[model samples]
Target: MGQGARSSWGRLLADLGSTLLEVVHGRIPADRPVGGVVIHDPVDEPVYPENSLVLAVGVHTPDALAPLLTGAGRNGGIAVIVRSPVDLTDDVRRAADDAGVAILGLARGATWTQLAALLRSMLAEDDIGHTQAESLDGIPAGDLFAVANAISALLDAPVTIEDRSSRVLAFSGRQDEADASRIETIIGRQVPDRYAQVLVERGVFRDLYQSDRPVVVDPIEMDEVVTQQRVAIAVRAGDEVLGSIWAAMDGPVTPERAATLREAETLVALHLLRVRAGADAERRLRAELVSRAVEGGPEARDALSRLGLAGRRVSVIAAAALPDEDGDASEQADQERMAARELLLDALTMHLSAVQPGAAVAFVADTAYGIIPVADAAAEDRSAALSEDFVRRISGRIPAVVAIGHAADDVAGIAASRAEARRVLRVLTTRAGTRRVARMADVETESLLLELRDLRASRGETASGFLARLVDYDRRTGSELVNTLAAWLDNFGDVPAAAAATFLHPNTFRYRLRRVAEVGEIDLTDGDTRFAAMLQLRIRRD
Candidate 1:
């Protein structure tokens, strides 16, 4: 019986040790008790709730404490047992020296506390494991590959990816070998059918684009000749639905079959999106760097020098990419967008390079742009006008909004000219208000000064008022005097061009010049009178 009891106690201790460690390590629920503890020797008996615990210890020597301690452990309770016997001191007794397992000591009481701590630790480990597993579930590489392979293996089905413009990027897994070939030819080509139109008429790509989940189209309901079967997954990452993967079977779709294919489709779509996203991020970075460089002059040139493209004059153009008026773009929107931007840049380069030798054009960020240094400043103007005309031509060929900026003589003018071009673009494209073409000459130092002078003169009783009065009299009466004065002064007080401006023949205008001396005012060729007539034409003419 003694041996059996010892074996039982040993087994219990082992279990308790393991369970205690797990609980204290937090492997178990936090609120769970690791083990029971009892502290005795208090005046009042402490009550613990059913799920909670307590420690009891009796205050006495070995002779007084044995029974209670022994009974506590045996009954699955713990006690702080004090014993005095043999050579064992109070410290030794507290550690339950020379006592059997039944007589647990203060050390044993601490053991339960350690066990609880161990359980808490374990719980933390479990949580970490759970999170890792969930993350794996969300985007597991092996799972994704398996799913994609499964999709490609479909016997009578063909898979395709599309951008918003319904341009196909990838096509695989076709029931018909000929269909595969046709789709291959179609890859990198825009789906001729508008996705929106398709959605309205047949509800194929549009429905797929709108769906947040998988959609299965019944082949029987669709046109048997053209669209035998269709199963698609909308490729969504965050709020953006990049496009979709559509698998078309040769026949009608069953629910079970659709469900099976749906998982694989979704996986393939997500993988495609992930791949595209990475590429897009890299491209965006490159484009942004180029954009800032183009817009930043010295800094841009520094960057260009680093890129081995310094000292080159560049022309910048802006192109807006948007949806075509007519199509349903459910599947291939992203591919179309990427292609459109690429195509625009290529087209711009081709067009510009054709005209100007060594002209380099590229996409500067989101828009298509071109840069070139020409033979002369005037030639640059002509080339820019030509480029604008060329853009207008191509814009007609492809659906796009194109805006061309003025040509600059050197890289230093790039940033400023780009600004001017953008402003002109807002004027031309947005039509937000009445716009005057922005010319560098219009904003030049001399022109600015003249404008400031005009404004200052406007505020005062200066040349403007005198000119207005003379012109007003001329309008009221059939006036030869005003014309004569204007012509005589324009001729440096000679009766010439000023008379022509007043709509009289030169000789007749000359007669008016002599008439000014006879009519109400100063001498016909007086310097003040001439200056006044000139100011009248400038400040008050319609």
Candidate 2:
């Protein structure tokens, strides 16, 4: 077996110890690779080479060090070592530390030529070993684990396979070599935001998406977050980016290693396609089950049982996007609406799963529905509160209204719950300025009023004669009598309170009331008349 063409900065430090070089300020990033060595000349225009360890032979001033370090950082150089007896300033040290580049000083009597020759020898030895390895001719496409294992062995580094969203699908079982960010990525199934920010700022993702070749990333050190060097190869099928294969390199990746990573990318893409097909089939099955349950079919209970939700009390929730005020309705707006719906569904799925496993959520007829299990008496209350919070959080992003149904004891009652939720949602859509999230129980009074109104309309019955006369008299004469009567009825026929509520004196209110009774030909003292008038007023209000 031959070694790969890669060597760490720590390894170079060890090989050049006899050349009287000493690390004075910043520590060596042991995981970062030192590709080669270059001697800096102050007379010439400075050029920093990528992955090269630079030597500032006789330059020591901060002005000279500032531009050199800054240029080296922009070009992706690893480190800059200077000869001793030159005064190094605090500004230069801080700059190197911020850029995550190491600063080392050589002891007296050591020359730049001697150190450069040693680095060349070590790199040459690495190349010789790499040339003896097997050719990158064929890669097995069927077994994903085998491919990951082979890449890890070939590069002698930990590897991770992730989807385009940065969700880890598979990783080499090497936790010992993993950092905090790596472990967090594996556990959370996504890259952490801090580390992701660094990669984004460096254009790492842009390079990966736009090219087929592997992109090498230098070591990153934020205030509290740090990561080792990495090489990323995009896994693409045709023009679509399927995923990526990331190798955590402890040294510079040679040409041979980069080629092997590209080969592994092809296998990853094939495996991802297969995985996506299976997921589609599974989603179809789940959608069918949800549809049947909503319809209350004979197989609904059986489907719920097969889905591991037997005998569980459940509630249905429906969310629909509210109409836009500006009424754009263009193709771009439609596309944006679709994207918002998808994001809302994704957020709801994640939230529900975190609170209760096996909760089923589906999108139907431009509305997303969730069937949440209520395991106990308190479960429904808890779920309702959580759903309210969920709606509040997404309200700014997705202008939607959410309705929740009453809890049912079994899957057979799911259809009734869904109908109730739809009814609540319908009422919300017609009314403006209502709360975004509502439950069926919260709208019971309005629901009953709706039913009464519908019954009256179907029967073709007009309003009671007492209400009709009162409304007509007020509209024709421009009188406040009808409003006064409604207010008095609402206050349980309290004349003084009604007068105060309408901002009139007590005697003036009594005079108006007498006119109201005289004009409408109704008795105010009779209990039966008062009740009848109140009912009519309520119905007319609805």
Candidate 3:
């Protein structure tokens, strides 16, 4: 992350500690810039970007926390967050110190998903390679957190900027000064239903939105959800209500503070527009450049340069979900498939962007492709490793295959790399196995055989010679002669193994093998004959 965008470690703790978070162990790196936030996916080996904050969701007990701290430290992580009520054993503390990662506990009510979103919103105001951020009245542009804090400072109260739906968008520090309801709202990133119901019943939202001036609400009469008085004003731009800003205060709102709240509302609206417009425009432009570059035509060179991959050797990673064998042709099913494709594409982009910063990922047609700038031809192995890790991470959730193409040295070779990557994807999708990631080199023979099968099918070919005889015999008598022969060949002529595979006694399998030879009128002893039989069996669709 750019300096214009990232938050320092000590600052994160100071800002969030009041409500949603608290450090459990290790020393804080006050100056370290947190580049990104990644959820600690326990099932898949993690990929940690430099200066990352890893959210260890569902990680309870000190034993689980200890190893995560160690791994995060080794991978350049800045900190880890587990759910609160942490045991924080001695071993966990030692591991955190050794790995140089701070373990923070999320407050009891906070959701990991919401925390991850809050952190991303903080860092993502700037682009991946953004150099410097423009400022709006001294605050960094589109930085809602800073805006919230500023409002908090001027009002001398903790603030929360919430959308019309009552979801918290950004919150200010000193939240500890607020009541339990405010704390609950911040942790969940949404107002509790009962609290929101009270507001609705009392017409608080109606009064707040209708009036331009700040509205003051009396303390709640219920349980200790709200004890502090609430001051809120709807955020707007020329009659458009963008959101609202709320401040928890002990005293009544004075004239000067009321004026300040109005001023803050206008600034907040402008910033909201800026954030939305900038993000949409940037995403469209970047997606276009990636799409064109990987497509590879007259515009490829310029597109690659724009993508920051100019003059660099690159490898392509192609990924696609295996077709669902049970798919129906309904429109809803098609829509579902398309949604799954986009989800996989987004996951690919996130994974690649974190592990390899300069890499570009985009969905081109049905395939999600990644173009990673590499050191050289040898870099394909590294690329393959990254792809494998990603596949393993998304394995059960998505039945997809990831394939690495050989390194492309220049603009001319980019298409070749993409094509080869598609070929590898083809091999993986057609075959059955737990292996979901591979490179062209690892499956060259399988790929060639697949191509041969395609050619043979296109030519209207069918099994011939002795193999055809056994097929006809099986079809006529309903015998297992051809399968028996295949099992024997598959086991390298080991009668016992072949019998085990066929669920038959060795003598019974031997009898079938003799039948195969006699029925096919073949020479079982010849190596050439066996090779031909195996090839035909593998390559023939029939």
Best by TM-score: 3
- Model 3: clashing residue pairs? none
Q: Rank the candidates by TM-score, best first.
A: 3, 2, 1
Q: What is the C-alpha lDDT profile of model 2 across 310-389, one tens digit per residue?
A: 68888888877787778788999989888888888778878888987888877776777888888776988887788788
- Per-candidate Cα lDDT values, in order, are 0.48, 0.73, 0.82
Give per-residue CA lDDT, model 3, range 1-542, as digits (tens): 33242656665566457656777777675776788887888889766677888898888988888898889989888789888788878898899989988888786644554456446655654344445666676888688999999999999999999999999989999998899889999999998898889899999999988888999988996674446789999986444577899999978788999999988987787677557546654655576677777768998888898788999889888999888888688999899889889889888989988988899887777888889988964566778788888888887788788988878878778878888888989889888777788888878878989989889889998778898899999999999998998899999999999999999999999999999999999989999999988888777632
| Local lDDT at 467 for model 3 | 85
Better lDDT candidate (1, 2):
2
RMSD of each: 23.1, 21.6, 22.3
If scored against the real structure, what TM-score would every candidate get? 0.43, 0.58, 0.59
Worst 10 residues of 3 by lDDT: 1-10
Candidate 2 lDDT: 0.73
* Candidate 1 per-residue lDDT over residues 418-499, each given as its tens digit: 6655544443433322222234343343333345456867788454344545556677896756545545555664445665
| Candidate 1: segments with Cα more than 4 A from true spot | 1-157, 173-188, 191-228, 237-242, 250-298, 303-308, 313-370, 375-385, 391-536, 539-542
How well does model 1 score by local distance difference test? 0.48
